[model samples]
Target: MSFQLFGLPVARGVAIGRALLVSSSRVDVAHYYIEPAQIEAEIQRLRMARDAVVEELETLQRELPGDAPAELSALLDVHVMLLQDELLGAATKQWIAERHYNAEWALSAQLEVLARQFDEMEDEYLRERKADLEQVVERLLLVLSEGGGGRGRAGGLPQLSAATGDNPLILVANDISPADMLGFRRSVFTGFVTDVGGPTSHTAIVARSLNIPAVVGAREASRLIRQDDWIVIDGDAGLVIVDPSPIVLEEYRFRQRSGELERERLGRLRHTPAVTLDGEPVELLANIELQSDAEAAIAAGAQGVGLFRTEFLFMNRNGELPGEEEQFEAYRGAVMAMQGLPVTIRTVDVGADKPLDRLSIHELRQEQGLNPALGLRAIRWSLSEPSMFRQQLRAILRASAHGPVRLLIPMLAHESEIRLTLEMIDRAKQQLREAGLAYGEVQVGAMIEVPAAALMVEAFLDRFDFLAIGTNDLVQYTLAIDRADEAVAHLYDPWHPAVLHLLHHIIRAARKRGKSVCVCGEIAGDIDFTEVLLAMGLRSFSMHPSQIPALKQKVLRTDTRRCSVLRPARGVPD
Candidate 1:
């Protein structure tokens, strides 16, 4: 009989394939204590392993497919940075010197220490990066286990299965590094399941970029499925079926064909304007992390770029943030790619989850016991580092000359923050004038992810040109539940009564003030809530580019006049 295992549904579509199992890396470790006299040799061994992983990551970066999503390359670069981080390997050397533990034992022990710190982080994105850390450590362990010579492939898993028939190979593993995931990009696997990972993990992100059907955090996916077993993967439902019955397989296969046809039909809507049946126009925009991703947004027929997460550009550069010219070129690339479409560039939002490359996670926690989400992040972090903050402002203002650009400030909760932020923008403009640089005017926007900001929308509208609702943080702060935490993730509801009321208030206030407001969160991408959002008076939505067509279809079928009809049933209030 076929059995089922469920996990987090990361991407869409159904895949029927034969299993290809990759073993877990956290195994077969020798934990004997080493003599003090042997400490130097053991430490050198760790150094060689770290260096080897760096070489491996660089090789993978050089070998990334020409068509690979640019974000994938950034992830690979992060892995190399992890290898160089003293927190990861340098601290382990301390264990060897003090406890006299073997290199493997010391490394794994250090991982446990750092993982606890990561677990305490408030940002879902940063918390999910623990998977990346584990994957990096796993690579180091692999090299040490194999006597300091790591292989091109991971865990001896083949790059491509021997069989490439109608039944594709499904990768089932404990975890996968983005680097290793890139290596398998051009392989026979059509879908995958991992024993670990959340929606925001780099692994899941890469899977989505590859357009592959995937499920992550299936605790037993690797242990239960045998090699070559017939399996069915339901990416939408986050389900994996092993040795599926013929009847069941046929059902999924039919559904798969139907999904393909539906996609083809939706593809026809790309050129159609997003106007509701009642003649109300809605703006559909794309949220991007990289300039190269702008092409994807254009391909999906986005009206503009809504959220350009600039932090990815600052990541994994071995402690050095990009300078103004480098940052300007990146912002310019996205602006130029949009070809007259406005691009909203949010300043780098780094906090506990997205610590600067040089920031020590352990030291910060020890020093402040800070909650990564509530601590220095977004506008707060930018304001704290005024020079770095000014560097970013100058770049965005410079990019505006290329085309329309919006300078969005994240996490503004006070009048003082608004004043300071505006002063900084004026300062950046002044600096540009002094330097004789060409720049253009930008529509400055405030991100309403902070409850305080949402509650005082009138104040924001008084000072800012527009408002962008970041529902991800709004929902997190409203419910006090971290979506990345497995224990509380189930309680992380975006449709909570409080969240709905908050959304209603923000949209209503923005409209009353005659200010443009757009929801640039995960909720904007979900088609199920389309009518409800419109019912709540929303006219603009920003989401992943892949989500544009379906959402456009939803808008086309909806009647703005009847949006209130979604009210009582969904518990929306006046």
Candidate 2:
């Protein structure tokens, strides 16, 4: 039987492939048969998974702070012992070899066997150890799932399957972090479905940048989809079709080809400048994370790099923050890669939804029953940790010498925060000079994310060299919607009359001040907003590289002269 699941259609394309499932927890894993010839390979996977878990446990133990609870340390040690026990690895390997089960299934089967034996044990303490054993197995299961098909440089999981055939793989996961989704650029996966994520999520934003078909917020996608199941992704319709009949498959294949042709057609606009039909030039920029993302930006013919999120450097590092030199090199690489194009490096925005690996989700929002969105994040987190903030600032300042670099601060709403931030930048420059380090000047800008900042746009334009409108957070804050929260994601409207009014106010304010302004949010990349924003006097857009072509196409068709009748921001709702 054929069934379909609905989600937010983020990227527009069609993908027909086999489902490859990844899980955040061990509760659901892909179970498939292994070929007789591949039994040894499966055992090797089990060994690698075990070793990875062991390494992770050892790292945790070594990094445990001296102030950590005695019981917590002891519990970690117990889990390490369970993971290192020879019997666990030996028995799990046996399951793979004898039963031809895949790595995750084999290891889980062994855990079940041990669990049953413990349930029948006479000693209560030994029986209770079953929970510890289960924890160890769960950890190993997560490693095996992330290990994917093969490993690449920097220990990246390159592909989802070793199978080299006609049908490509489609990743189905409970949820994927933005850092993990960056790996998709090199992976063989044709498309992906996440059980939880809103349309404007950072992960979804990264998915769009990857230029792959994606369906997010599919409530039961991970639970319902099984390994190696034939799947059809109608990204335009936000539909995931499973077990499609031959007739339906044929129809989808045709649609897939049509989408491909359309993409190919858009590729022709890569080198063309974005100009309205009336000859108003529009600048399109790219929002990149890693240094390697520069190639995609240049290939996409972006005028420059805007909104270089520096926070991604601090994620998934096991609590170890990148030092000033490391940060400088990373920043420099991006500037150099742009080859004279300007790169705007936003200061690290960690906390809230993008907490450091050391801080759990609960820890981020436990105090005052506070919502992370409203908690200390972005500039607040940076301001709270002045030393770290200075380190990042010094690095960005040094990178300025290599190429044109712009400093962007996120989520600022107070005069005191702005004053402190400016003083810190001066202090960082002084420290770098005292250290005899080469540095250069950079234009400092502020991200207008909060409604408070947008309301006081004149104050921001007065102090800042430029302004970048982060429409994602602007709408969320304006509507009191947590953009990342799926429960109210639909309420997070970028087209709210108030949101449009704010955008109009900010853009109008910037123009009046003769200061440059750019929209570096998800809505900036949306082709639907190209003409509307152009009418609002927005001449610059920063977004995922994949979004540029279609937007440029829209820009080429828009007539700014004719938009005078549609100029009023309040006229949007009417």
Instruction: Show model 1 residue runs off by greater than 4 Å.
Output: 16-212, 222-231, 243-250, 362-370
Model 2 global lDDT (CA atoms, 0 to 1): 0.83
Best by TM-score: 2
Pairing residues by index, what is the TM-score of model 2?
A: 0.81
lDDT of 1 at 134: 88
Tell me the tens digit of each residue's lDDT in model 2 across 1-574.
7899999887778898977665333354555556789888888888888778878877988899999899887888898888778678888787667756678766755665677678789999899998899888887777776788523222122233344334577888878766566567766788999888887787677777778889999989976776557899988899999999999999999988887798789989999988888989999999998888898899888999988999989976777889998999999999999999999999998775677776575374756577877777899989988989999999999999999999999999999999999999999999999999988879999999999999999999889999999998888889988766677778877878888989988998899899999999988988877777888888999998878888999999889888655756435532
Question: Which residue pairs in candidate 2 have backbone atoms (N, alpha carbon, C) closer than 3 angstroms, thus clashing?
Answer: none
Candidate 1 residue-wise lDDT at 60: 95
* Candidate 1 lDDT over residue span 1-574, tens digit each: 6899999887788988877565334454444455667889999999988888899999999999999999999999889888889898778999788766567767766776677688789999999888899899888887887874222333233454333234477888787754356445557788999888766555676676566899988988876776557889999999999988888989999999998899789888999999999999999999887888899899899999999989878765667889998999999999999999999999988764456665566257737865667777789989988999999999999999999999999999999999999999999999999999989989999999988888888899999999999987898788876544445656778778889999999999999888899998877988888999999999999987888999999999999788788777787787
